[model samples]
Target: MLQDYTIKKQPTKTSKLIASIEFILVLLAIQGVLLLFNQEVPTSEVAQFRILANSNTAEDQRIKQEVQKKIAPLLDQAISQSTTQQQLHDRLQHLEPTIEQLAGEYANGSAVTFEHKAALIPPKRIGFAIQQQDVYDAYILKIGKGKGDNWWCALFPKVCYPEEATVTETEEEPVKFFVWEWIKSWFS
Candidate 1:
């Protein structure tokens, strides 16, 4: 004969409370692991490289690309030997004059200034890791007035470069409040 497997009694209040507490504990444990990963993956030791154009004009943007192409190789050579953030920054500082000269030449008369300093980077989700907005060591190259669109990447982590080290960015998903939603689901 076929068996009737349906529940004959609803769970008691105490049992329901126990189940909910267990679920919450599991969620907390998972969140703790995620927090640890976020803290370690995207580090403060990142070094950024940014090229800013004089204006938003096509000519200015073209000059920006030309500079980028020419300067990227020299940077690749300079930072390749460094194993730590301090070493990378020192190398960049040493290479500053050459970098400016190359960019100035590629800029076609546009005024160029190269600075290696601490700069603010907006929050970015590059590949699977989310990099929070913070100040980082950077090499900022300004063309002419330096008021236009800019091209930048975390040179240390290599977010925008493929052959360099590979990382990501292109519209990240928004953060979700899963705990609130989970609680509502239980009530419903």
Candidate 2:
């Protein structure tokens, strides 16, 4: 029974200091992750583009599609010269007459009106960026009565892939976790 007795090793001050440092490091890592997760995507930097239909009639819808096809490229080209939202708005404002003319080319006798306004829009998902149902500065082309369903896209970020564009999804990358490896390093 006397031979079976064993003494336990007591923790040293250096070991206590190392444990305290490790605890602080883990807390910092947790805080970094929390900050990343809690951050909201800023909406002020986004610019919205829209085309409102004259009415839901087949002919009206067809004209709307034609105007969409024609004017989108021009808008892209115009904004390509811009670097800021204000510049984008200015470029569009300066080009409004031209835009209205081009929109009318495909509108086919339908009235077309263009404007830059603070407009209320529905929540929209365009790529990974989302727009909540809120008012935003927008470039709007109202076709005819403008009483039907609308077409919208993210004009500034260019996140909305066109329906005609083809997209190939990449395979998911494997996640390499480092927290376990980091903890294991303390023993080695």
Candidate 3:
């Protein structure tokens, strides 16, 4: 029988380089998978409510209903009052105080400020009532429209686009404005 011989193999530079590249690729793939897992998963439903601390659960529902009923009439009244061009400012001013009072009352010692967008601008707030009761606090419709004319689908964390307040020469032109194109440019 011939003497048994064994040879130990040393890793070659080419093999080492190949292994390193493969390891790096594997790490990258793993990182990609982890990133995918961590990405924000959107909820199918837009409305997600968190329980407010010290909120009266019973009163909240009742209040939400009341708010919805009031909105339509309030808006109509505002438009009617503003029918006269000169009285338009007065119409806006009249509504501001009422909203402020309502917001303050609703806040219940917690601070809240009412913000109004230009009339030509899309509605920022849209409220719906719970079938159970006629209360203003049941559901507050917070809406935010994007740069497009598309009616803002109500969403949380209201969207605000910076607009310049300008006095217009003609009534037909928007009094204050930020075109969607200009707003987009600012971001770019």
Q: Largest TM-score belongs to which candidate?
A: 1
Give per-residue CA lDDT, model 3, range 1-188, as digits (tens).
89989988987766666766676688799988766655332222121211122233555445444544555566567656664544644665567667545644544454433343222222223232112211111112321111111223123112222232233223555555444444344345
Could you give candidate 2's per-residue lDDT for residues 1-188 as a string of tens digits? 35777889998767966986888798999988766655355678777788888877888888888888888888898778889888888888888898899888877787889977887766776554455767787878998778765444434212233332334444658876686566566666
lDDT of each: 0.77, 0.75, 0.41
Q: How far is candidate 2 from the true structure (C-alpha RMSD, Å)?
A: 14.2
Candidate 2 vs candidate 3: which has greater TM-score? Answer: 2
Q: Backbone collision count in every prediction?
A: 2, 0, 13
Instruction: Rank the models by lDDT, top first.
Output: 1, 2, 3
Identify the leading candidate in terms of lDDT. 1
Task: Name the better of 1 and 3 by lDDT.
Answer: 1
Model 1 bad stretches (over 4 Å): 1-40, 150-188
Flag regions of model 3 displaced more than 4 Å: 1-65, 84-86, 118-188
lDDT tens per residue, model 1, 66-149: 989998988898778899888887888888888889888877788899887787766666655688767787789999988774
